[model samples]
Target: MATILSLSNVNKNFGALTVSDDVTFDMPEGQALGIIGPNGAGKSTLFNLIGGTLAVSSGTVQFAKQDVTRVPAAERCRMGIARSFQIPHPFVGMSVYENLLVASSFGNSGHHDAKAECRDILDRTGLLPKANRPAGSLTLLERKRLELARALASGPKLLLLDEIAGGLTEAECHELVETIKGIRDSGVSIIWIEHIVHALTAVVERLIVIDFGKIVAEGEPSKVMADPLVQEIYMGISVDDTAA
Candidate 1:
């Protein structure tokens, strides 16, 4: 299992507030890594650091065996790193197909046939039927799917997903889990930051729990979720104190 992305003693801060504290982790090729934590646990901030949306205060970030701590976001995307926002931000005036076309053309370095690539991603994301619809008209789930399609259109080896399962109906979430499973099966590595425990449990081989900007636990999903510290940090005392 070769490493696709590695963070070594990474740290980030905004004024006196520390968001990521010496956090370190690795994603192996073709594996899914789930991140869980309570609110304000810096899960999203960690993604920002990895995707180059924010500068690390200290430490190193390596992608594909190359140091990328100083790489720009666009360069990171071109280097096979792509991410979806926690909030969907589709191009407001653009059609869904057009949105993906832009992602294919620009985000992917204009290296692929934008139309074909866009249609393929839209189909995989279950957005094909709505391809010509205006992005601004989509419902929440559709918006989220479009967000994922945009990222996928970038053709990444490492995909950073931020709560793509959030705000979906149970059936929709299940559908999304299957979609993600297929994506993983295709050999793209993923680091998913999500609060939907069951969704993650179904798709990820491993889990990492973070608290107050630091990793608290990392292991197989069940074991990581059952860890006492993880229960305390994510599920609070109720989970830790519950009877067997």
Candidate 2:
């Protein structure tokens, strides 16, 4: 498979604290890459660097073979990179369809038809029936789906998802995982940072575990999670004592 994104010797620092230390990886096209880590592990910061939300302190970001370390966020969106925040923050007053339309128009250079794209986005995201409802009235699950739809509206080849299943109920997370699977089936490469392990395992063929700013494990989902180091990180997080 072709490489969709590459991080080479990436480094990000906050004053004297190093958030990302010599991080390197490649997200292959049409594949799902799962990133799991404890809170404050610089997982989201890694996404910010790839999606152009934050400037890297040092190193390179290559997307689709073009170096995008200095590229502005909006330009990166137009270049086929789109990310959803951990917390869904849609335009509260706008309808779901309207929000998607705005993303398609602005993020994709105003080339898409507003009405057509809005309907298609809603349909694709399982939000067609809620298209006319105000975004603020959505439940947590709906909000998560909208966040995904907004990213999809940008027509991304590489999607960066940040803890999308954080607050969803178990059943809702399963539904959302299916939605994500549909997205992957449509040929988009996904790099999802999620704490919902089951959902991640269901969708991602490969998993990468990061700790203290660097990846400690990367391989098939079951294999990576079974590594002693990976098991150690998740040891106290859940009451379920079964091994990964």
Candidate 3:
């Protein structure tokens, strides 16, 4: 498959702290890839680097065969990259529909009938019923839905989901997972960073385990999860030790 996004020896530093250490990976076109690791392992940092919110310290980022390491976030969005935050903070004062309109207008240049497209996105994300509701009035799940809707309105080819399922009920998470599956089925590539392994596994074709800003493992979800190194990162002990 052709690569949609590629990071070559990407690195990010905040003074003495190196958040991304020569991170390199490729996201195949139309693939949903899951990222898993302990907290502070540079998961979000990688997203930032990919989405153009943060520049790489010493590497290249390519999107659709174009070098975008120096691209601005807005330009990248217009170039088909969009992301949701771990904690959604949508336009609180605006209605949900309005939020989508804003995103579509900005991120989807030359899109005709953005309103119709936004409506479709609202329906797809299960946010149609609340489209007229103020964003600030939404519950956690609703906010997350709105976040996904807004990203869709941006017309993304690659969607970056950053812990969007962090605070949902089991039922709520399942609903979101189904919605995400629909998105993946619709051919939107996804890079989901989530602690909820089941949710990621349900929607992603592959899994990558990151530690200290580098990919520790990458493969099919089950095999990657079962790797002793991945188990130690998650369980804090070798599987042999745990069994013994």
- Between candidates 1 and 2, name the one with more favorable lDDT: 1
Q: List the residue pairs that clash in candidate 3.
A: none
Q: Which stretches of candidate 2 lie over 4 Å from their true place?
A: 109-112, 239-244
Superposition-based RMSD of candidate 1 using all C-alpha atoms, in angstroms:
3.1
Candidate 1 local lDDT, 134-155, one digit each (tens): 9999998889998899999888
Model 3 residue 198 distance off true place after TM-score fit, in angstroms: 0.8
Predicted candidate 3 versus true structure: per-residue lDDT over 1-244, tens digit per residue: 8999999999999999988888888889999999998788899999999998888899999998999999999999999999998789799999999999888998845568898898998998788998899999998878988888898889899999999987788998898899899888989899999988988899998999998888899999999999989988988523433576
What C-alpha lDDT values do all the predictions have?
Answer: 0.89, 0.88, 0.90
lDDT of 2: 0.88
- TM-score of each model, paired residue for residue: 0.94, 0.93, 0.93
Q: 50-81 in candidate 2: lDDT tens per residue?
A: 99999999999999999999999999999999
Residue pairs in clash, model 1: none
TM-score for candidate 1, please give it: 0.94
> Once superposed on the true structure, which residue ranges of model 1 sit more than 4 Å away at CA?
109-112, 237-244
Q: Alpha-carbon error at 191 in model 1, in Å? A: 0.6
